[model samples]
Target: MTARETEWISIPMTVDVPYRFAAGRYLTKTLTQLRDNGRIFAVECPRCRRIQLPPRIVCAQCHVRNGRWVELPLEGTLVAFTIMFLPLTDPTTGKPHEPPFVYGSVRLDGCDSVLDHLIHAEPDRGKVWVGMRCRVVLRPPGERVGDLSDIVHFEPLPDQSRPGS
Candidate 1:
């Protein structure tokens, strides 16, 4: 077979798969609180006292069942980040996000874990930083649909200076 005429031909197909996800008690509580009360919730391991997002049944570090439920502050500090330049597919919608979006992990105040999500700041070093202060912006109460999608994005709080600025 010539290089131009390969033995195998490629065919593209679209999938119309439908499915549902079970969040269990731990996640259901978190998602419901966010959707109904406009709040972020986490769980802490009674042993290590490390708080975790998504409120797991057991702590990975301590291997202890988390018992304490805590509400996290809306504000947080950016601990790590990346400026994505590709059309990353969103798991929930099965669609690609617009390119050049700022995404990052923010350690919410009074919580031991960092929640990662889309950052609303410009995808630039000057605008985004490791220690930048950000606030979670959620959809309107009536518009919330009991999922993480209710979070619009993390926007930088006003009057915050970039590191070394």
Candidate 2:
């Protein structure tokens, strides 16, 4: 009856739960546009003028219905990122994204929210950084399937240097 033995132990496990549901009005419109035309769309909050991606029906801040549709440019800035050292399964495709990959949240120009996706860049610290300019790389129109996966990944734009050097 030692105190160390009485301490709680933690265990990690993976649970595979398969499910499907409808992508309501807002998201459906966003995905459809990406799939059909390779265009990105978001909803603007009438009151606050905040543009949201993966458009939602109501504004999370203003509590008003989002009506105005805004087409966002493919280019944006990387707001945050991580170099993953583990092989993580992509829930959307059920495939494992190999380790040591770079992924991050990108705020597309003129939009308030950010999109998270893989970044096609070396995982070296000297290469990727916050505020890196990037562009969405989408699958060809005919190959798209109306899902976020329609976007292959974000590619860093050329001729840009880090803030300090």
Candidate 3:
């Protein structure tokens, strides 16, 4: 086929699907704890000793069944982050998060996996950064549902300075 003879076609369509999710054994336990007791739980791999959030049945690292349930401290380090300028839909709530917000990945104390969520900080570069210490903020016990949305957001701890600033 010659380059000038090519035909381009475009189609536009929208599909809407709604469904409920079954959290199953491991995740249900984790979400339930957060909702009921305001606690975070992770599973530890017997072989590799890797601690994972949203507790999984098997360890990704060692391929062994994860059994030990460890309670993680709410405090963690903000290992990565970004100041978002666009309004993005929050999948958990099916709502649009307002623009000029902050989002980041937090590595909770003692857990290997990082949980990504909104950061309750000013949308300014000077206000947020990697290595910033943060703590999980959850809704009041009665208001919390058994889901990741139980966490309102991660708030940066006070009295800290960015490295080499």
- Against the true structure, whose lDDT is highest? 2
Error of 2 at 151 (Å): 0.6
Query: What is the lDDT for 96 in model 2?
Result: 97
How do the residues 10-103 of candidate 3 rate in per-residue lDDT, one tens digit apiece? 8999887799889989999999999999999999999998899989999877888999999999999999999999989876667999989999
lDDT of 3 at 51: 92
Off by over 4 Å in 1: 1-6
lDDT by residue for model 1 (2-79), tens = 977867788999888788879999999999999999999999899988888989999998887899999999999999
lDDT per model vs. reference: 0.92, 0.94, 0.93
Candidate 2 per-residue lDDT, tens place, 15-54, comes to 9887888999899999999999999999999999999988
For each of the candidates, give the backbone clash count. 0, 0, 0
